[model samples]
Target: MSFVIAVDGPAASGKGTVASGLARELGLPHLDSGLLYRAVGRALQVAGGDPDDAAAATETARRLDPHDLEDPALRTREAGEAASRVAVHAGVRAALLDFQHAFAAQEPGAVIDGRDIGTVIAPDAPAKLFVTASPEVRAHRRWLQLKDQGVSLDEILADIALRDERDSARSTAPLVQAKDAVLLDTSEMTIEQAADAARRIVEAARARWETSLKGEASQKG
Candidate 1:
């Protein structure tokens, strides 16, 4: 059996960093589930397909190669918007569902991070964290990241707000924290601080899950 850690959050939150840190601490493989949608979105852009066209978007997702996810372009604002657009299609989401599930079921364990990992992809995961920050704090982080590249803080803030709206309002796999997920608000927390807190949470959750499993085994035996 595999232990799964599902970390879900909106754009620009520290989920990716926290997930990476947690995976390193736990010796588990990590998957950025959003990259799957970004891959499809990039494919659509390359093929001149309309993101709003469900059939086109679904076809793009169905034909996606895992290699395509390695593209650095998927991290761009345009690609993120495209991803949000294509992700609204249920068929597109279904096309990528199995891929995400396979990643989560890896031997030993896995850490998967994205908007819907907790609520949809890995609802039974042993550790689920909903990482978030205020829009202002997240936007500031983005600004600091791209300031040298000539992007404005105001533009980044607007983009973050708009992306949040689209992601939360999407029909399929909307951005929502699962009921049992522990919330990690990083608005006032530094990266090191966030990672420390996350480590504690996952350790506790994993202990509980392992105890439950042992109890079940005893009952069965």
Candidate 2:
């Protein structure tokens, strides 16, 4: 049935939680595409290669195993910084493109979450969601997760805002919502509420697609 769910959002926007929860409920494979860049960054860091070296980053990305993507350290601030740098490299992005696409085409369905899933990775996906929240709200959520006591509030907010600018301003596969994606503003909503909304949107689209198919079959008959 090739049902694909593309979920896109900036960091700490609740798309990851909603996408993971939705994938569990729907029994589909979930791919966190951002992790690809994170994995490459971590690998390069481990190998003592420079993140700014496009050739090294591209090689690291191409050789990245699924196990590399599973590193718990990939979630660190240093890894995020490394990823942001290398992800802007054209060669690095080209190297990892196939892996994301293959993951998105798995058996019955798949759910992909990233800043560019809807815009670049899975433009043909039937269901697309753009999750977002105000910078203050997202910053608070991120601060809670990192729990860095020494960092000032202004630092945290500025970091988040900087990441937003870097992500959106990048020339390659910049983070922007597909025109047809359903916007999910989770500024005031719980993760459960967001997941419920995502499920409803995908289900309704599936129903419409199925109905259209049945209509065609009837016409042929």
Candidate 3:
């Protein structure tokens, strides 16, 4: 069985960093699932479509080429905001469902990070983490990443707050923590510390998974 790890959290929560690091340590492929949404959003923007148009956003998501995710433009703040808008559409979420599932079904396993990875995309993943940090800290971190663009810290903080509200209030696959997931609050931790804590969590989950497999085998003997 593939040992899938689903990492879910709000924007700027450092879930992506943790997921990528864990994937490397475990020799598993990693998927930054948010990039898929960002691609859809960016495409819609370039086409002059309104993000709130469910049909248009859904079509954009359906037609998204995996290669489009490599576009560096999708990493920008504008693309991220657009993604948040499009993501609220149930149709858009439905369109991308299969893509995420396929990634988790790969050999060995995979590490996937996004808002709904644990609660919606990969609920049965063996290792699930819900990473988070305080809003102020998260805003600060995000500002640091984009300060070169001349965006003010206050503007970024407000944007983060709006995104959080939208994500949690969305009707479809809302951002939430899975009941079985371990929560890692990185509010005060350094990147290295957060990564270390994530490794320990996954290691524990892996051991439990192996023991369950052994128990099943013994029962069949």
Q: Which candidate gets the maximum TM-score versus the true structure?
A: 3
- By lDDT, the candidates rank as 3, 1, 2
lDDT of 1 at 110: 98
Against the reference, the lDDT scores of all candidates come to 0.92, 0.87, 0.95
Query: Which of 1 and 3 is ahead in TM-score?
Result: 3
As a whole number from 0 to 100, the lDDT of residue 104 in candidate 3 is 94
Error of 3 at 42 (Å): 0.1
Instruction: Count clashes in each candidate, considering only residues at least 3 apart in sequence or on different chains.
Output: 0, 0, 0
TM-score of 1: 0.97
lDDT of 1: 0.92
lDDT of 3 at 63: 96
TM-scores for the candidates: 0.97, 0.93, 0.99
lDDT of 2 by residue, 1-221 (tens): 58889999987898889899889999999998889999998889888899999999999888989888778998877787788888888899999889988988887889999988888888988889999999999888877867764656666688889888988999999989899899999999987788788889889877876787789899999
Global Cα lDDT for candidate 3: 0.95
Expressed as tens digits, the lDDT of each residue in 74-189 for candidate 1 is 98877887988888999999999999899988999899999999899999999999999999999999888778878899999999998899999987889999999999999999
**Stretches of model 1 off by over 4 angstroms after superposition:** none
Q: Which RMSD does model 2 reach against the true structure?
A: 1.7
The candidate with the higher lDDT, 2 or 3, is 3
- Across 1-221, the per-residue lDDT of candidate 3 in tens digits comes to 89999999999999999999998988999999999999999999999999999999999999999999899998899999999999999999999999999999999899999989888888889999999999999999999999998989999999999999999999899998999999999999999999999999999999999999899999999
The TM-score of candidate 2 is 0.93
